[model samples]
Target: MTLKSFALAAAMGLLASTAWAETKIGMITTLSGGGAGLGIDVRDGFMLAIAQSGRDDIEVVIEDDQRKPDIAVQLTDKMIQSEKVDILTGIIWSNLAMAVVPAATAQGKFYLSPNAGPSALAGRGCHENYFNVAWQNDNLHEAAGAYANTVGHANSFILAPNYPAGKDALTGYKRFYEGELAGELYTELGQTDYAAEIAQIRASGADSVFFFLPGGMGISFLKQYADSGVDLPVIGPAFSFDQGILQAVGPAALGVVNTSQWNKDLDNPTNAAFVESFAAEYGRLPSLYASQGFDTANLLLSALEVADVSDADAFRDALRAANFDSTRGDFEFGPNHHPVQDIYAREVVQEGDVFTNRLIGVALTDRADAYAADCKM
Candidate 1:
């Protein structure tokens, strides 16, 4: 054989040997304590997709950050340094997302965000290594703010936790609702009791109240809001009153209005199949959180099907180009590394045997986020 043929044969042998090797996916999420609802949903969704795709080339290493940013950094460091994972995925909070994504990207590993899109990463700080399968931090809230304006909800009260996501949510709400301001309250992060705030809310005399709180926070707030004897209409983003909260808040979430990019009620074949299969696998209705997680995994699989994930440049180019069809009806990358999609106004309603928030109105069909123009990336 020629010398060139011998070299080619040796390279092909190495590729064949590593073809069945485990592809480690380091998933850092809030798996313990109060934040487990969303994390569990995301985990189930990812596993469901993996099983359906029938690709055994991946092994997922799931860890719970427990909603602590410090623990997230530590666990992610271990995953990157010790396990030598091929990719990193799943984060439930913005702070944790910000803390871990940079490390993953700096090492030239792909970081897929199933949830949590911090505001800073959407602008000039946007990195090519990071890809969000969820909407931007403010994207859903911005849609809620627009709906507030459309419904003539002027002089509204706003409440959010005193943290990065809380600040971003309120900022997003005010971006489009150009009406008279009533009052804004920033509470401590993870505070369970909303009685004090409920009292304050009663006295604020605002026409409507808008809030952004996820997981346990939403559960507590929705229950308290219903019991507080406040008659005003309550509005929030989907994350604040999602399936996770519905299980906790029970009937308290009824009649609440919120906005989201995807809901199970969407009339599309992709979503229908996903919801049915997810329910059969997990024995529960899938939330948008789960849908996004599944979509993130599917998105990676799509790019991998076309190009080698080990080729950093090729994978990044394909993801940045948004060349895959998302289960959310459409897919397009905005300038800020976020997605431009439809935003639906959903209301908490009981559909058949399950209690859920279904889309009642189309808030913004094919909407672009407010910060896209400001983003220079």
Candidate 2:
């Protein structure tokens, strides 16, 4: 062959190899057991983004964590060491995120969290390779606390599962809530019974009750609370009143106020499209978890389009730029890699047969996380 032809052939071979290179993502989320609904929505929302991207060069590996920290750790090891994924995302629980994110980021794999931002990761332990697309664990509850103060609630009863996220939720609430606590209770993780807690609240003389019980626990508590006929105002973070479980909670959740960063009715083009598309595809309303998952996937996809995941610095920069339109109208990252955005108070209301949240008012505006100063990176 001529010298020119030989040179041309080599160049074409390199181009072909680059075109076929893959960006593998490992998604470990709770897909079964108690928090299955939240995980399923996240997985589905993430997969929808991948499908919409229509890029054959990107590959995704999904696994069910079953809300177990040990199982999530095992999955992280297998994904990073064996499957050789370039990016890791999708963990629903704070404990699971804690188990997997630090270890994965320490090993040089990029982790983009769709849900579960623990305070430990946000503050002193922040890693350069870790980014949380969702708000820091305290953001919503803090907004709820602020709202409680606005509405003249003097004494509030509070309860949460005894875990890292649960503790963070209460701390977040109390950070802004200047009122005295009527009672503070910690329930067991995945506890199905709230009868005892309800009795305590009934005797505590609290003007309002605030609780952070996600997944099935929320459903159980709300149902039992309604049945007990304790007529105090109820408030919580959006986790308990998410669209995935609102229907299950039914009338029990009606008129309960909660704080969240995203709602289906958010009047932004990106959010409107997301809500419509999610409902059409999944046959249900999208929850805050689903919004976080969608945003996380889009953020990754935006970075992927501009920089290859192998180029760590460029990829991280692109992810941090947050170029894509967010379902939450205005979204930016704090120095700690958690979201800085508005948190709104929403009231659970029934629209036809489906239960959902409606925006009442903004609780916090342009809020940065409490841990940004601690993160040097």
Candidate 3:
């Protein structure tokens, strides 16, 4: 062959290789509203992992959903149709996840959930292209229920927002609680005032309270509940009391028991490095949400090393293998594409003015999602 022909052929091959090497990712998370703290942590943790990976081949497009389902749907459409993202991740709220995931997966794009594992996506609606790196919505609450049972809390007041995830949270608590409800209540989404709820809790004579409010709602409730002077013990999912908002919740959150899949003090090399590096980078401790984001990014990077995103089957299998070292140890995906890992009871404690959770004990071991059986996929 002529030298010019050889050079042209080589250039064409290089162009194809470069195109194949690039993996475009889109991140839609709540970054400007009530739940912004959770989304910020997830985005930061995810970016931290991507930076650590030092892979120039991955390009990311990030958008703020504003905690609105309509905005999330719009962003998903733009990302898939215009941005041409190979993967989508970093949604904080279940409502937003529900709006965006099915559509994204239906269009043959991968959706890796760093947070928000609504039971709907875990059960009969499960999609082959959807992977939840976080626990199912019910996992932590179920653990909370188990903890309540262990602590002999026979009659508990339970409350969450009137939403799909909120209902799932209360239902999960009842599944393993083996107790009578003092009162079951649902608050408006993003409701800050808890005066009426506090009054009811005080009047109900309940020995304990289980709440599933996240982000700003949790902070408000904790502060109000403390000021109300109700001596009832509080139990909730770690989302309410995670490191991101613990300082905001202040000492009011102290001694509260919560359930989580990952804690900063999990005693693993990956977790140690993640907690230290995350604190150094962000000037605060990492939350369970942050840990999930970090893990999700690493999971994608791991899959990228072995499989090209263009091959959906290969990429899905690579993700299911879960090759990365998780901050939450013993992490693996269940048949329903949700995590099967241990959930622990965590008690909020103040360590030099910063509130954080200490691992108290394991609430559930090697636990898989309850909806896995319902997942036909």
Candidate 4:
């Protein structure tokens, strides 16, 4: 070939490489320890959405936080300084979120929360570039409290772990429940044995019980509570009653009503497709965490379509628009960049030895976070 032709081909190749640089997304999630299931679902769902979008101009970097706050902090720094990721997402626990989110967003990088929506980030600590695709920490707990009232739970006993989300849970339950509190307890985080807690509940003289334990904590609590023969009707947020947790809890989770923003049985074209596709791809039903991850990816994809990430103002405004069709049906961002969406009451039922949740009813309609009013943004 002539020298001129070869030079032209080389010039074209360099131009192609220089243009359309793939957008980098860093995901710091719990993938190899307690609560790994939650983070795994989030990662799979996010990847599923990205795959279906068929977009070649995006790249994702994933790291396991190992359910440690320090690990999450380190991952955040590595993502920002070394990986040069433009966006960050996929954190499961509130304490880890607290350790990672503030510093990441403060650096002018966008952080989209697929889970772990702490109250501080929703209210006085709100940021322009931070978006919570999942419900606020209080959203489902508040719905559980509201549903508890309608079901004639005039006096209730509530408990949660001693973390940020746990504190948010009890506070949210009290905010909406008109009932007198029979008792309230905060267990140590990741406490496996709930014997003492159950003993207290058994003696508390409560008509009903509500808890906000997630991951293995919930499985242990439910099994022990069932064995203790506390026949009082129990209610909780969907964290404890997720598909994987329910299976581990076995019959202990049956008939327990939990509140959530999405369920496999929600009636909508979008949700129907998600459920069908997720089951086909993963060979299992999608849980609340999975749905949130799918939505988070789609939300980011939509914003990327309309505005470049380098233009922070335009991208932030696009995210505030919340242009994705969520599995929960309608979804939009409130002033605080948290979701303003409906919460549903779901009941656990067994189908051929497999445990899953079905939508019983809408617990709260168009529920906005209690902290939204406090957010100046």
Models 1 onward score TM values of 0.92, 0.94, 0.94, 0.94
lDDT of 3 at 197: 100
Q: Tens digits of per-residue lDDT for model 4 on 1-377?
A: 99999999999998667544778899999899767999999998999899989998898999999999999999999999988899999999888998999999999999999999999999999988889999899999999999998899988999999977899999999899999989999999889999999999899899999999988899999999999988999999999999767888999889999998999888989889988998999998888899989999999999999998988999988999988888888999888999989999999999998999888998899999999888886
Give lDDT tens digits, candidate 1, residues 157-263: 89999999899999988887877767899999889999998888899889999999877788888898899889788889998777766867888888888999989
Give the whole-model CA lDDT for all candidates, comma-separated.
0.84, 0.91, 0.92, 0.92
Could you give candidate 2's per-residue lDDT for residues 1-377 as a string of tens digits? 99999999999999767645988899999888867888899988888777777887888999999989999999999999888889999998888888898899999999999988898899999998999998899999999999999999999999999988899999999999999999999999889999999999999999999999987899999999999989999999998899888989999999999999999889999999888888899888888888899999999999988998878999999988988889999888888888899999999999999899999999999988888888887
lDDT of candidate 4?
A: 0.92
Ranking by TM-score: 4, 3, 2, 1
Deviating ranges (above 4 Å) for candidate 1:
1-16, 19-22, 373-377
- For residues 189-278, what per-residue lDDT tens digits would candidate 3 score against the true structure? 889999999999999989999999987889999999999989999999998888878888898998999999999999999999999999
Which pairs of residues clash in candidate 4, taking residues 3 or more apart in a chain or in different chains? none
| Model 2 lDDT, full chain set | 0.91
| Regions of candidate 3 where Cα sits further than 4 Å from its true position | 1-17
Choose 1 or 2, whichever is better by TM-score: 2
